[model samples]
Target: MDKQRENLTAADKKSEEIIEDKRAVQIADPSKNSVAGKDTELAASQVGYQDLFDNMPNGCVYYKVLLDEAEDPVDLVYIKVNSAYGRNIGRSLSELIGKRVTAVFQELTGEGFPCMETYLNVALLGEPVNFTQYFDQQDKWYSISAYSPQPGYVVEISEDITEQTKAEGERRERERQVALIERVASLGALAAGVAHEINQPLQALKIMADSMIYWYDKGKETSVEKVIESCRKISVQAGYITSIVEWMQDSVNKAWSDAPEEVDVKKMIQRVLILVQERLRAHGIQLRENSCDNSLMVWGDSRRLEEIVIIILVNAIDSFVCVDQGAREIRITTSCVEERAVIEISNNGPAIPDDIIGKIFEPFFSSSKSGTKLGMGLAIVKSVVNAHNGTIQVFSSNQQVTFRIEFPQYRQSV
Candidate 1:
């Protein structure tokens, strides 16, 4: 019921991908196909249309509406379904197509009743709904969406979000419980200095509050001045809380957000190097860029984008294996083509195996045999990049590995 829970409840959920699919649908009028040299007969064939919808890679559903005695939208019947939909829920089209909405969905929920209420509202209103709700009994994250194209029936689609959700949850939990503890311990080491600095502000606020209370108690018909002073004291306290929360949120989302923002492309490359300055110094890696042009601007979160560069560069530094390997160098270059910024970062390291390039983006995949390879760093980077509407590729040959990332400058975010 709190704000964050409410946010999760109202999130894009499974519909984010569904919405993207909707955008990809190029529905054309069957009537115009003949003149356009299109398959007019194929266009008019409802069976073919239904078959195509059913055969789609993703689960698809089509529901029919049936009204009640009161002329209100009351029932739902699945008029069409794809094989994926049936397989996901372990139900045949015949079993689900004619069932009442409440009857079929009522028992599948974890919280039982609350989820049912959410469904009923969507069914009655004839609107599409999306949320990251869980079916407690199923114990998995689902990107779920319910749509009612007509007055009385609802169509629903669900996608498993477990892997991505679990990764994010684990990352967040570690930051909250583990990383914060480390940060707090570090703060504790500076506790005396922090306390002494904080006490000054606390004392100032308290003195103002006390003076305001005295004035308000005295014979002032309307204590506007005192009220303002008290409000100012409250602001000071709220400021402290805001600072802590902002610091935490910046550390969290700046490093990783489900969605990435398009950045000024020319600036972002330089910015990435700035982020890895300490690492470059520590590893003795000489970094160079081919072009320092001012024209390109790519799309994506600079923070997460920079993380990818840092991870790859760190691996490049590690590839030296010995400090005596003459000079460790990483070269980065970028070009813009058809408004897409193509960034290439390459290192002169041992060649990556031909088989390994395909699996690098897979979660928990690593080339390193050491215990230190958590295996998810690159996976997170790829996920973050993908969510930004970009693509990443790797090419490896003798003594070199190249990561080529293409970022399109969306005039308006899609």
Candidate 2:
């Protein structure tokens, strides 16, 4: 028994010596030790990364790109996916892992697999891509970010943005409603001017018809030339009345459109002047217009551009209510400078208060004491101008208030 115990002790000592020699070699050979340490660290890092990826709030997917004969990436093979990814896509790990992307998104074949080109570029070219996509099958919107993890491999992260998209759409709809209401209110304020405009042509038609009937009833011989002249005059007045009514109807009923066209600034100003001229004359406000003889063109909706002029003109007309009628003057000028179309509308009515000028374009901000105005006209004007990539500024000094608007000059593409 003593001999066996000695042998056992010798064996144990031999093993201990062997272990110590290996430790000494590792310490002496720093490179070997470093390599071994790096391997351990790499393994630990991979495990940690896997844990983080699986636990990320956003969905994450890993794919291995499959190439064709031309070395062009043709399809992606699902290698790994986090729980969040499966949840977001409404699929199980069993359904995705070890499966081709085409098999999983067979329904999207009609659309050529959404972002297939984008994904392949990321995997093969190492170019990262970020984009938003709407998944019809899932009825959701997602913001996806994809980048190459290594050659021929990509990792994608996705965040659901359906609610955000819906909210933005709803907000735009609400703005459109508010803008429509403001336009109707503006037309209401111009009702008197519009009535006067229609009445003048109507009164002419009545006078011409009355003369013709009087000639016929008095037993006076009516010459063919006189009858033709009266008919021509009546036709002109009727056409004029039709044009005014048509313009008003279009203004009230036109829907907002995104398509833009080249708008002649001079013609637009003339049309708006026709609508407001009677109002200006009724208020004894003198109008001075200095427009370029050459056509000044801008790229935007004609109706919205017309609205901008009308809003400014109406504000100018209202400004005269507190001033003596004889001193009221409004000036409008259009010019082109530095590849920009510039419009300046100035009024000599009481200058906008220094404190209120800055806030005039803000929605629902009014300086009027009547409490009947919602003050959305200038706000809508600013919004429309910005939508057209234009700038508007106000200057008030020396008993004058001027609104200067600038838009990029329309240039025909070559």
Candidate 3:
């Protein structure tokens, strides 16, 4: 019995040795141990990537391209989405994943969502695109960037920009309000010139009416032709007066509201000159309109353009306060240069000091010696020009100060 126990123990030892040899082989072969380690590391790496995707602040989505019978992408299938994506769309992952985009947002079907075309291009072409979209259903704006990560798969990252868009809109509205205020101020400054322009016609009308009244009251003989001519003159004067009042009213009412249109530069300049002519004469300043092209045209609000001309003209007029009236001259020229309409208004007044020229367009910066002006005129002028996609420059030399303005020439589309 003892011999039998010893043999059994030896057999058990041999079996244990065989198991240890197998374990040693497994450790010595990289294919077994290293492969297991590699698989564990790969699983950990995938988990880490998933964690990062879920934690991203911006909404992230992975989409699989859905193709029509023609092999053109028609819609997208949500393959995967991060937590922020669910928060952005107000949907859970269970509701979004494996769902078609059209089914998720039914209103986006057909041509309603133009962004689908951009997405399709990105997915099929493996390109990247960025765009901003406003969703009426959500009442929000999103700035989205999308790129294809692989064939038939695209990744999109989106940020909510609704607040930013609203802020920008509010900023624009405030600017418009400020511009309106400046326009009113400009009109106030030109009130005297406008009144003078209206008065000339009023005086002519008075004379014509008085002549007709005197002929009838004094028993003076007059031909029917003479009476008819007097009536015609009276009508003409009345029309002129009406024109002036209407022009002023239009300027005040549509300073900031009117849509851009083709404006005749020469006709506009001529009309402005009519209003300021009396003032120029009063100051003994010679107004010279040189090289004004009748066909010169620009695209802008005529009232605002008129305001620009008037402001610069007023500034030029004020520059002559200390200047010798006999030597004062204001020259206006309009021409086309390099597909641009150029207006040059120069005055032979005191030159703008070198230190002040740069700040002329700044709000509340005035070069006037009297210091009574609000100094918003040139600032408003700069704003108006910029709003119209135009430019204005000033140069002064040899007792001559010139305001050079350029606007893109209006081209009628064929």
Candidate 4:
């Protein structure tokens, strides 16, 4: 019994000695057991975080806010940006890190753009901002989400929406074209003028034929010179009819081509005026022009540009006829500004209400209650201007309105 107790004590001592030896080893090299392993674990965690960041579907940009003397966020430096963010900015990821936001996108820092202010708000106030914005220069749409993860730091996530926006625009354009055709079909006033114009040329041709028949009936000696002259007159009148018919056919067909060429601005305007002048006169609307040099040119489709002018003129004429209160007058002026050609069409008619002015260029937007109204004319005009890399704006006040269109002047490549 005493020998068994002694053996149990020795076993207990052996277990204690083993534990003590392990404790000593840990004390001698603590890093191998805890600190070193912890470092390895931390490194693996960092690599995971980096991998997650790099593979994120949406564009991600991390910014460190630079503050003013008042501790207000004045600017932001790109601390880190993912590959998607670099592509969205049309730059390399290596080129963007450490760059300032102002240096990266100068337009955003300007007064008209709200991106800089929105970012600053998130950074300084720790507020989250989520919105969709169209970047005109980039010609893209982005669904942006920004939030401050820490003081003076902001993270922005962006998803590209360009394809979605383009799809919507294409759908709207198709609807607008259909509505335009329906509206034109309903315009009896314009239809009557077109018919009258077509008939005049036909009537003249008939009169010349009748004169030839009379000469033959009386057996009068027809000189070859006179016959040739009569034939020439008939040809001219027939050509006029053909031109008017072709114009109507093309307008109704709505065939648009992407091929662009050097277009004489003055000649295009004259062609449009020829189409609309009679209609304007029938409506008692006087047209006046403060001419610019005919030498000014633009790079675009002449037919499309003429269509834009026609839409604006028709809209103006309709307003004049609708209001029927003031002197129905449209004044046109053209000039060159820097590298752009500017055309201004002003009318002394009913002023467009301030509330709806911004909506005028939107598809299917119209304030007029006329049955013939399509509300797509100005929208088409805006689309055409954008296609030509041009800009259009409206100013209205005191029963007067002006549409100003500016196009990049076409210069021949040397």
TM-score of each: 0.40, 0.76, 0.71, 0.46
**Model 3: pairs clashing at backbone N, Cα or C within 3 Å:** none
**lDDT-better candidate, 3 vs 4:** 3
TM-score of 1: 0.40
Model 2 lDDT per residue over 183-239, tens place: 676566456556777787778889988988898899999999988998998897777
The global Cα lDDT (0 to 1) of model 3 is: 0.85
lDDT tens string, model 1, 15-81?
A: 7867766555524444453455556655678678777877876567666655679776555556777
Q: Write the number of the candidate with greater TM-score, choosing between 1 and 2.
A: 2
Ranking by lDDT: 2, 3, 4, 1
lDDT of each: 0.64, 0.85, 0.85, 0.80
Order by TM-score, highest first: 2, 3, 4, 1
Worst 10 residues of 1 by lDDT: 185-194
Shift of residue 239 alpha carbon in model 3, Å: 3.1
Give the least accurate 10-residue stretch of model 3, judged by summed lDDT: 106-115
Number of clashing residue pairs, candidate 4: 0
